[model samples]
Target: MSTQIVILAAGMGSRLGRSLPKSLTELSDGRTIMQQQFDNIHQAFGKDAKVTIVVGYKLEYIIDAFPEASFVYNEQYDQTNTSKSLMRALRASSSGGVLWMNGDVVFDPVALERAAKVVARDQSFVSVNTAKVSDEEVKYTTDAEGYIRELSKTVKGGLGEAVGINYVSSRDKAALVRQLARVDDQDYFERGIELAIEQNGLLVEPIDISDLYAVEVDFAEDLERANLLFS
Candidate 1:
């Protein structure tokens, strides 16, 4: 099955405190976060797939950096969240499976390969990384078998990190895009997944990407952690 990467890069990123979009933030290696994301995708998918990114908040910066990426502008980016951001990309894609990701999470190429392989089997897989994040970090709960059960806004006890990478089959991908279009309330993309799970009984085939240092730059402190992890 053909696969595509849809990146959510339209958030305000207020925590980063930078004028540039979070995805454009420079890493110690000189490559920006968006660059790393595309590089990793290229390494795993090669020339077989395309990279689609949802741009908002300084959209030009991200667009200029990755000229090849299929840009879908989220006009309501400042008003809404990731769910709306993701919907923009989903509508842009015509057909085939899609690998949806959040711009903040940086991952290794192997982690993506693992996610892709799982999706190859079911074509609807989402990864859960066993990160030791604080209780405030977003939590991803999995079923006993490792399939994603729910994505909780608040963490309870300790939960795994999502790593912001998920794969959806062509049918479900279209359904989800349509689902978001129907929803009157503006929720983030994670909420859309939950809705898919509830309404369509869609299951998430989960792969663990815990061992790698996949960083989510939510705040300035996260930036420090990322530097430590990457450097």
Candidate 2:
């Protein structure tokens, strides 16, 4: 089955203080964040990979720039969060699995190799960074069998931080969709993953990507670090 790719770009991303959508912010190399993400997808999954971008805040700009890719608009983007954005994407997807990422993340293409293997096997996974576990970032801990047991920012004894890259197999998609729909509007997509693990027996593996560079450009400092990958 063809791999379905989703880029969640609906949030206002006011923290980045960019006039355009956060994914449209240009790097020093002159490529927008989404532009780099599109290139990385093509590099890793090939040009045949189907890409769908979730848009809301200034949706027209994103639509106009990447007209070739499909789009899903989250009309309540101002009031909702990633949970709703991701839910919409999941609902719109086919029965096959999906690999998705936050729109602002500029990541190393090498990480996609592991993600591809996991997705090909129909295993749900979350890319993690054991080297960096910030109190503000989404963190996770694995079970005895190495499946994600707890995922959220407030989890105690977190083994690592999730890197804004994740996948949902065909088997677990419906459970995740239900959880995402039941979550509060302000909740991040991680909340739904955690709930799905507890209520639906969704076994999500945590893939370590610490050795690779994947930066979510949430702040100016983060943007600097993301640009350093090209420097």
Candidate 3:
């Protein structure tokens, strides 16, 4: 099964307060977040894997940064969240299932490669989870078999943290995007995932990545922590 990579780069870094897009924000090495993410996925998936980026909030920065990849703009990005951005991008570009992921997190390329290997066989979506929890990590609730049950960053209790990387196959990609598009724009990707599992009976599995720390940049403190962790 062929896999494409869709990097969701639409959100405004309202907290970051940078003129450039959040994805284009520079780290220590002068490599932008968008570039690092793109390189990481391409290195793992190989040159054959098609790369498309969903851009909003300083969309031009993303376009200029990654001239090689296809860019899909989200017109309602300010009003919408990541799930809606994903739906818009995937709906516009039809392909085999994609490695749908956030552009704001720092991840290991090898981990993504492992997901691709697993997703190819089952045609099921695979998400990353961690047993370790921090005050900052997004927690998730899963069943005995590691299927994500619920996701919340602020909820008091849950199973584990969602590491923000997902692998979805082409067969169900369209259906999944279509299902999510029907939801309100503010709903998150995990909410859509929960809906798919509950209403549509989609098989969305979880791959625990507790050992691998995924640094997500949400606030100034997060950015500082990521710089320390990834630098």
Best lDDT goes to which candidate?
2
Cα lDDT of model 1 by residue, 1-231, tens digit: 457778899887988899989988888888888888888887787866788889889998888888887889989888887877877788788777788888987667788888767767656876776756556555777667766677656646536766678888876887788667766545656677767876887777767788877878888887778878877
Tens-digit lDDT track for model 2 on 1-231?
Answer: 679999999988999998899999999989899998999888889999999999999999999999999999999999999999999999999888899999999998888877988888999999999997899999999889999999999998999999999999998999999999999999999999999999999999999999999999999999999999765
**23, model 1: CA deviation in Å?**
0.5
Clash count in backbone of candidate 2: 0
For candidate 3, what is the lDDT?
A: 0.74
Candidates 2 and 3 compared: the better one by lDDT is 2
Which portions of model 1 miss their true places by more than 4 Å?
Answer: 131-133, 144-146, 155-159, 182-186
Number of colliding residue pairs in each model: 3, 0, 3
**Best first by lDDT, ranked:** 2, 1, 3
Query: Which portions of model 2 miss their true places by more than 4 Å?
Result: none
lDDT (0 to 1) per candidate:
0.77, 0.93, 0.74
Candidates sorted by TM-score, best first: 2, 1, 3
Between candidates 1 and 2, the TM-score winner = 2
Which of candidates 1 and 3 reaches a greater lDDT? 1
